[model samples]
Target chain A: SAVISQKPSRDICQRGTSLTIQCQVDSQVTMMFWYRQQPGQSLTLIATANQGSEATYESGFVIDKFPISRPNLTFSTLTVSNMSPEDSSIYLCSVERSINTGELFFGEGSRLTVL
Target chain B: DQQVKQNSPSLSVQEGRISILNCDYTNSMFDYFLWYKKYPAEGPTFLISISSIKDKNEDGRFTVFLNKSAKHLSLHIVPSQPGDSAVYFCAASKERDGNNRLAFGKGNQVVVIP
Candidate 1:
């Protein structure tokens, strides 16, 4: 099991502003992922962040709207650009301990509210 | 389309009884399934998982049963306690692609009472 943490557990921002959420893992991981959970809905994968590489984003999400930065193996950040009311959701970061186990550990999640 | 589905939004079980949470998937290509438990304002913690080759996997008091033919799976927690009350999520992944990416269902809120 991995100990994951996210900064800015809860934040309120005005429309047109951007919010960046950070994820830190206690140990190095192979793959890191970002997801969004709308209120009363299932989670949607936003992107896959690999160290020293550009993030691979899923459909309906782009780097322009959601820029990701992975400076090293144990840390990554996801920034919601030009935020709108619809951007309000709980953002979660997850990492796979190893390629063999196929299990994921998630951060506590960053809840963002846009006004 | 929702590849993974947890039909029940919430379940209530008495303390010391068995609590069963069910999940179904529409994708037959998915070969691995996992269950995660989450508390308020906390990240999901991995509970149990089953591979496509196996029908049942147990860990401690938690057991996961998988029925590939029916595309269904369930998580059972015996001797449920009040602290067991939390949201449970069911996730699936394909054996190929390294089984890293997962598709999750809408969670089911389980409330255990004394």
Candidate 2:
């Protein structure tokens, strides 16, 4: 199992301001991902943070809105740009422990509230 | 489209009883299925998982059963304890394009009463 840590566990941001969330893993991992969880909703994958390349965004999400950076295998950051009330959600970082088992370990999410 | 669905929003069980959470998926291509437990203000913790080829996998108090033909899977917790109360999520993934992207289901909140 991999241990992950996310910064700014909870934050309140003014509308139109951008906030960046950092994710750090205790060990190097190949597959790192970002996910969002709205109030009373299931987790939704925002993007896959590639170590040395651009992130792969999911449908309905764009890099312009949620920019992601993966400088190395152990660290990644997700930025929510031009935030709106709709952007207020719990953002989580996860790492795949093994591709064969397809099990993921998640960090404590960063809860965002836009006013 | 929700590839995975957990129809029940909540479930309650008495301590020491069996807690069963069910999940269904429309995508048969999903080769891996997983169950996660989450507490408020925290990220989900992996509970157990089963491969599409296997029908059942057990981990001490937690067990996962998959019915590939029905495209459904379930998690069973025996001797449920109050500490087991939390939101449970089911996730499915298919290996495609070298990426195994997970599809999550709406969670089911389980409350274990003492």
Candidate 3:
């Protein structure tokens, strides 16, 4: 497990607004991921934050809706654009704990409530 | 479509008793199975994992059992403690797929009472 920190642990946003969540890791890592868990739902992978390149999004997620930026290996950000009530969920940042096993260490998630 | 299924949404156990969580997967491509635990207002944390080549892996009080033929897996926690109460998630993936993407299932909330 790595020392990971996220900003805006909890927030309430209005519909049609946008919010950006920041994830900071203690050490430089090659792979950083973003995951979202909706109410009563499982965690879904939003994208993989690749350093020095555009993030790779999952099938159901689009880069326009969820823009990601990885300026450096130790820092990354996920922006939820044009949010709606249905977009309320807990977003998390995780780093690969072990590449061989694909184990991840997650930070406390950022909980969003869109009204 | 949900590839992984955890039938029971919740489980309750007494202290010092055993807590069992079951998980089933429909995708045969998933060869690596993992269990994660989450507390309220926190992200899910890695617990234990088993490879397709192995049937069982034990770590301290937590043990994971895998039955590849049946596409079923289980997590057993012996001598359950109150601190063990949390939501446990079942996740599967193909390690060598190059991408570390994982499919997660609805977590099971386990309450340990003394």
Per DockQ, the best of the predicted structures is 1
lDDT of each: 0.92, 0.91, 0.93
Model 2 iRMS: 1.9
DockQ of each: 0.70, 0.65, 0.67
TM-score of 1: 0.97
lDDT of 1 by residue, A1-115 (tens): 7899999899999999999999999998867999999888888889999998899998899999999999999999999999999999999999985574558888999999999
Which one is best on TM-score?
Answer: 3
- Badly placed stretches (over 4 Å) of model 2 are B97-99
Best by lDDT: 3
Model 3 is docked with a DockQ of 0.67
Pull out the clashing pairs in model 1: none
Q: Tens digit of lDDT per residue, candidate 3, span B1-114?
A: 999899899999999999999999999988898999999878788999999999999999999999999999999999899999999999999866643688899999999999
TM-score of each: 0.97, 0.96, 0.98
Instruction: Name the weakest run of 10 consecutive residues (lDDT summed) in model 3 chain A.
Output: A96-105
Q: Sorted on lDDT, highest at the top, how do the candidates line up?
A: 3, 1, 2
What lDDT tens digits, residue by residue, belong to model 2 across residues B1-114? 989999889999999999999999999889889999999878899889888889999999999999998999999999899999999999998866343478899899999999
The order of the candidates by DockQ, greatest first, is 1, 3, 2
CAPRI quality of model 3: medium
When sorted by TM-score, best at the front, the candidate numbers are 3, 1, 2
Question: A-chain TM-score per prediction?
Answer: 0.96, 0.97, 0.98
